[model samples]
Target: MQSISELLKFLTGTVFAAMPRDMLRELVLPHGHVALLSRRRADMIISRVRMVAGLFAVLTPLWIVIDLLVFSWPVTGLLVAGRLVTTVAFGMLAVSFRKSIRMREAYKALAMMFGIPTLFFIYSHPLLSHFDMAGPAAAIAAGYAFLPFVMIAGLAVFPLTATESAVFAMPVLCAEALVALLQLDMLNWSSHLGAFWLLFLIATVAALAGMSQLSFMMSLVRQATHDGLTGCFSRTSGEELLDIQFHIASRSGAPLSVVFLDIDNFKKVNDTYGHDAGDRVLRTMTEKLRSNLRSGDVLLRWGGEEFVILLPNASGATATSAVTRLRDIGLGTRPDGDPVTASFGIAERIADGVTDWHQLVEIADQRMYEAKMAGKNRLVGCADPIQYEAVVNA
Candidate 1:
């Protein structure tokens, strides 16, 4: 039985690791796990917002129908009509958002998109004035049905962090209970307090469970996509990022540049000193390169002694200039005072061209080989792979 449980856990973790990148990046970690995460890590905020909006779009209208049928709608005709119209409109907008996502509009649109439904959820009790006639006991019982809805809503949030869930739930419960106390005269103010507190406790527990699920997803994603050695992106994740940026650049007619770099005589270092020294050199070089990159640039540990860089909206010449600076500041020297340096090759996507991301990487890689042949510690950047000169820049 214990073995079976362990196997199940492993499988569950594998499934989480295979989930979408856009979804995983926004997940919150457990308490004391904050040290394991980078708060400044870039998130696919637009993609996540679209996913959330798409879910609510499908859910809100269905909720409208359910409320009208299950709850007393006749006495709340105007409120029902308004809510139905609002939900349908939100659904329509969400459908449009799905087709082509754009930035700068994400935060505002997502705010309005989520804000409308949340406000409706809060004021729903006031809208259902008939709950007063249903008696306090019946009204309170019906309110409990919303617990499932609340849990479902947590999915839209993705990572319902520990305190975050309560932060969102408290207001809705308090508003509902307060409104119920006012409408259902049979429930005294004190009676409403007990209901509110009870629901708060229940919702917090459910929300925390939801958050734990998200944290589990994060752990798997981090393990699968991040390189354990240098804490850089794994090659698989790097490829995904390249594809995403390629499509973006294709649409915008922006240049997408890729650079392939190799540490000069890395094997010599390992054979001469030790594997531990080689690892230290890799970590140090990775940090130096990473710090000098622009905010949007991506760095990947392509393999041992090799790294790949993606520079969106940069041309080959522009990228060459940037990497030359890196060569200038390359690992100054090893523990034994031997000089450390790296070689680079750069390629850029031409506008309205037929080249693919893989092709671009290949071109850069070929130039990297040329750099190795041209006496090492140099860089090559050109549209033609074979024609690029492995110029000594360091």
Candidate 2:
């Protein structure tokens, strides 16, 4: 029994070790990075979805002219109805789309953009299939059949995960299979199979294209939002994150805390040891702070030698305790072989009764300044700075 268990464990470990984890992640899962779903990415995808929908709204109805010229009045009328309905749906989607759309909402819009054409194809294909194949009508039938391919190809325009691309293409694929089933008496089995094979190949290619776009977007986001040296969020992106978290906390009536931290005598490090050593100190400090933070907490490089830590759902007391623990652990050694230390100030939303995120930051900044003045390497986390100051002076 022991041997069997050991063998199973070894086989499981070998299988996992041999797997291409990065490739699997790209193909099977959405990015776990918060920046990937940031408001910037949401807006970009929403704008693209609107543009494609608007284009389809105009193009879908215009195709009715060809239907009228090629087919009989009865077939043309049925096709025109489907086209009009599809056009209206796309138009409504394009016009009603808001600029502040979220990620999930963007995904729904993408689905609608693909779905309208797919429904039109399902309705119109059977109408065209009843007639004999040849002439302009044969050409028209071919156009309807290509709708699924066109929709799958459209996936390349959006930044989507491979999983999202595959899921979106499923409806179009099913519609094609359904339409083919309906026309089995007209076209041979071999033709349906061949068409399905082509679609599968096209979907695979489209998924790869979408994943490439996603990768490109992620690279851009990382460059824009992260600090190049310390790997923490940049000051600009950090402010945006603060605003987002503040509003979320306000809406839910949850406590939000901000910790303003400045390295004690950081400027002296640069003046004495040079800027490269200072940069190393910043990176090392960031690493230590990150190691002690919860997964949901955010660390931002506020500026040179200054950092901000956003602690969502944490009270003033909780943040104070956390910062104290970090202070006790220390921030590693400096180039001069002295231990690095920092001044910390914490402010909580409910405790401070601040109406906006800026106020919260200002309070934390003031307290941090007070900590600096009260002799370096201290924390001022009290809600009432006046009382804390009196005690410090006393």
Candidate 3:
């Protein structure tokens, strides 16, 4: 029984080991693990979409010359009309692109980017099929058939999840299939099937490439945003988050809370036990705080022995109650085997009437100083500090 259990364990471990460990949940799901990561990724995707759309806008109208030269009269007119509409749509999308574009808007922009060409392909293929032309005209008309392939291959340019890539590629696939169905009388079933099979292969490869880009993007974001010591967000990323959350709260009329926490006498731990022991205490405290806080709450390492927690949609009273419970439970143990403690300062956007996130952080920092002066290991908020002198004195 023991040998069989061991074999099972080994097999499971081997299977997991072969899988890409760093391919986060975001690689498979359309959404990211954190809102901030999703927002950043959206901004990147929108920028690229805008650039590609702009290129299409410029290059699309120029194709009218080819239509005039290859085909004559009404066919040329119909093709030019379709090209104008597509060019106009691409132009509008490119000009409207902004850094603050949301994920929903990014997805919509990507769809439209692929969508414009698909519509053109559908409109032009039947027109082209009507003409039994030969030589260069035939070759130029054949180029229109490759539009779906080009669009599917374009998916490789952006960092998108497997789900997002599949979703975006679906419309183009349908468009190609629809055009093939319409042209069944002009072309044989075998030729159409072969073309579709090739398109599917290209789409599958493009989706895989997109997923690879997403994986690399995830790695870059994780390294850039998180602190090496505590695995908390760095101060730079924290500032960006504060600005984003604050604006969101202000717009929605929701409360945003900030908690400024500082370890008590942290220098002594480094002075006595060593920097390694101090590192352990920091890691332990981070684990305790993360285990206690809600998943939505963001923890940032502000500086040495200082951390900031952002609680979105949480009021001052809610933050006070939560942190009080945490205090009661205790943070963790120090190098000396004694209880580890911290001073906390809380500030809420609605309660403080702060105009900006900077003001909120400043208020919290000031109250943290008050906590330090009123005796350490206490929480100072909108009202008085939570006194722990009685317990300490005992």
Residue-wise lDDT of candidate 2 within 1-394, one digit each (tens)? 5865575466434434433454346434765647434466578778988888899898989988988888887888988888899899999988865866477777778888888888887787777777776787887687777778888888878877768888899999999898777663356888888889888877876776676666666667778889999999999989888989999899999999999989989899999999999999988889999999998999999999989999999998889888878877778889988889888888999999999999998989989998899887778995754313222223
> Per-residue lDDT for 160-277 in model 3, tens only?
8878888988998898788777763266888888888878877766776777777767767878999999999999999999999999999999999999989999999999999999
TM-score of each: 0.62, 0.88, 0.90
Clashes per model (N, Cα, C within 3 A): 0, 0, 0
Clashing pairs in 3: none
Q: TM-score winner among the candidates?
A: 3
Quick one: RMSD of model 2?
7.0
Tens-digit lDDT track of model 1 for 1-394:
5865575466445545645654443443333222123221113334565555667667656655555555564644655675676666666556554433333344345455545655665555454434454555356435643643453354334344545455556556655565665654345667666666656555644564555565565676678778988878889888877777888788898899999988888898899899998888888778888888997788888999899999989987788788877766665566577767777888888822536789888888888888889877778776644333223332
Best by lDDT: 3
**Position 106, candidate 1: lDDT:** 40
Model 3 ranges off by over 4 Å: 1-23, 383-385, 389-394
Please give the lDDT score at residue 127 for candidate 1: 46
Model 2: residue 209 alpha-carbon error in angstroms: 1.0
**Candidate 3 TM-score, C-alpha based:** 0.90
